[model samples]
Target: MISKKYLIVIVGPTAIGKTSKAIEVAQNYNCEILSCDSRQFYKEMSIGTAVPSKEELSAVKHHFIHNKSIGDKYTVGDFERDAIQKLDLLYATSDFAVMVGGSGLYVEAVLFGMDEFPEIDPSIRVEIQNNYQNLGITYLQENLQKLDADQFEVIEKGNPQRLMRALEVCLQTGKPYSSFLTKNTKKRNFIPIIIGLEADRSLIYERINRRVDIMIEDGLLAEVKSLQNFKEINALQTVGYKELFAFLTDEYSWDFAVETIKRNTRRYAKRQLTWFKKNEYTKWFNYNESSKTIFDYIDSKKTETEI
Candidate 1:
């Protein structure tokens, strides 16, 4: 019998040390790193997105990091197709590959296929975007809450793009957006061993706060400033950039913007944990776990499954 290939998924909230662990494991297994972090895909938003450092990128080969221009239109569906193709190619030369990221939806897209939605009128999306731009996220948020309370509760409400997408889906389908979510899992050639890294809530908040400080120290402000012209882009609708952009627009003071970034990131981390926790297949470990311990667990899992 042919041996099964393995896909080691390193998942956790932001700033929980998933990157370093991924590198160490990939180095040991001689496999490549495939990042599923939705923010890291853009080339223009490094500091805010927290792309891996030069030394870490050099330590192991990585894919999907800084691979797209912010001006390009990319979706979770696009990433799902691209990632599967890459994994197919990687499996040609190696039996193991590593994927690490904090984007729960993107990670799920690669694992279980995205739900198929009916092709609605293009004007519906345009109308949603116009409402978001003219009336603000509150308009979309209130609408989504009224239309699909369940999806509104789970989705990242701070993300205008997500809010708008859900609203559009609800209106276009004349049904709750949550109604489209399917529980079916897609079959894949590779077996996934999901590893989750976590810390206590207090510690996780502390790390998030410190990471935001480091991002400011590393010139996240300047990076956001450069992308100010592209603020309308969906990729810039995230935590770090949005808060800083508010500062740039004089919506808040510099210090207040930074504080908001920290607070929003903490919320995002919480949401990430909630999403990953739903996956019972994930084996949880402390964020500071030694790479060897994780490697051994992966080895044991591979043995158990392969036998």
Candidate 2:
């Protein structure tokens, strides 16, 4: 019966209407939804992360939404284990479940077990952090660029934590961070069918800008302000919160912070698309495509095994 189980993954860039599609698919299959969005895991981040509306959540059972606090250090590996356990329970009674989010790395972890890497001394990470704090991110960025040009080009250089992680790995292993990535796929009980929603780049940019405006209207500034003390948290170092934090520190004008948020969000969406596109298994759909079309595709994939 494990072969009969299907994990429907609804993936796309931010503001691509993945939430709506995920809910619709879960309802059709009479299944629960497991969220893979990294930001939505933190309960403190709701409006900025665009968590599902109460009515939408009440309409269908959603798991992993606001399930962790900002203070919790939840990694993608942790999420993969947690998700598998939850999926096992869901599969006990149903043949299908929906997983949805724009975080491609987290999505990939759930689909294929995370790539294993050499264990490095904690002191290497500490040294990198110390250098980053004293010498600035530029120092870490330059070091990574020299150590592993391939990863430097693709990794999000703006995130110091990610940069430090890559640098420390390279220094400790004396190898490019990219060299550790494994292509071997992990076995899972359920079949994963990835559905990606896409739109014209210009249209996506417009939608992102509009969504940022909506978040501002939804009291994102106040939410960011309340978490000012926690700005050092890795979770808050992200787009909306980072830009707002800059404003709170008198580093930028209010208008400039809002604009920066929109700009950064657009960039993040681009990175998400790049990551998802690498997976050849993902089927693409237009953002406005009807639920009936998606349902038909899902039905086609659902086949009976000869007993």
Candidate 3:
């Protein structure tokens, strides 16, 4: 008989030390790490996305970091499929695998699976795309807000692709996009031990500001400059890159752009905290908590579940 496999998921807001904690756990279990952070998947986005350091990567066998290009059309669905396959291969050699990221949607996709929406009409998508091209993101945002305010509250408002998809679903089915999100979750093979690291809101913001400053000092502007021609790509439409792109185009002053990146990163961290807190099963810890405490909690949970 096949032995049961366990997936240890480390989740938290940005700059919260989830990566280091995940590495510690992976080392303890002697297993590989699977990255679920969507932004860190691109090879071109290193400093701004806060991809793990070379030392961290060398400490553990990691999969999915810097595996794709910014130009690739990858989605949460694609990650879910690829992550599960990687987990299956890991479980064949070891029973425990560590998955880490701040991307709540990607984590939930791997844990509970994605919500299924009906096939959209081609014309609906085309119309939304055309309207987005001509009228800009505000048009899509306004439409989604009118159709599904709940989804509007949760989605990345600046991401035209997400806005367009939500608007397409709302228009195609004549119902709120969020209504289709209620389908029963798909089952998975391994049991997940979800862990969350949190800190005071003020500390979280401070860390985000410091991290952004470090990114700028570490040549984030040069990285953004290298990808300036691809600034319009969906992958580059993120907090750090977008703000710096505006600066490069004379749309924002240098100080203003840097401040905007810090402010936006803080907001993103708040959203991440809100998303992770909704999962009651997650055992929350202080950002500075020791790895041994976390390991003890995991072992206790494992014992209880196996009984």
Question: Which tens-of-lDDT digit does each residue in 1-307 have in candidate 1?
Answer: 8968999999999999999999999999999999999999999989988899999999999999999999999998899999999999999999999999998888988888788877868999999888888998799889999999877766888998888788888999889987876466789899999999999999999999999999999999999999999998898989999999999999999999999999989988988998899899999999998888998999999999977
Which scores higher on lDDT, 1 or 3?
Answer: 1
Over all chains combined, what TM-score does candidate 1 have?
0.95
lDDT of 3 by residue, 1-307 (tens): 5578899999999999999999999999899999989999999999999999999999998999999999999988899899988988888889899999998889998998888778998998899999999999889999899999977877777778888888999998999987776356888889999999999999989999999999999999999999999998999988899999999989999999999999988878877887788789999999999889999999998788787
Q: For model 3, give the 10-residue run with minimal summed lDDT.
A: 177-186
Candidate of highest lDDT: 1
Q: Which regions in candidate 3 have their CA more than 4 angstroms from the true location? A: none
lDDT of 3 at 91: 87
How many clashes (backbone atoms < 3 Å, residues ≥3 apart in a chain or on different chains) does model 2 have?
0
Residue ranges of candidate 1 with Cα displaced over 4 Å: none
- TM per prediction: 0.95, 0.94, 0.96
Candidate 2, 147-229: lDDT as tens digits: 99977866776788888888988999999997775456689999888899999999999999999999999999999989999
Please report the TM-score between candidate 2 and the true structure: 0.94
Q: Candidates' lDDT values, in order?
A: 0.92, 0.89, 0.91
Error of 2 at 284 (Å): 0.5
Q: Rank the candidates by lDDT, best first.
A: 1, 3, 2
Q: Which stretches of candidate 2 lie over 4 Å from their true place?
A: 1-3, 304-307
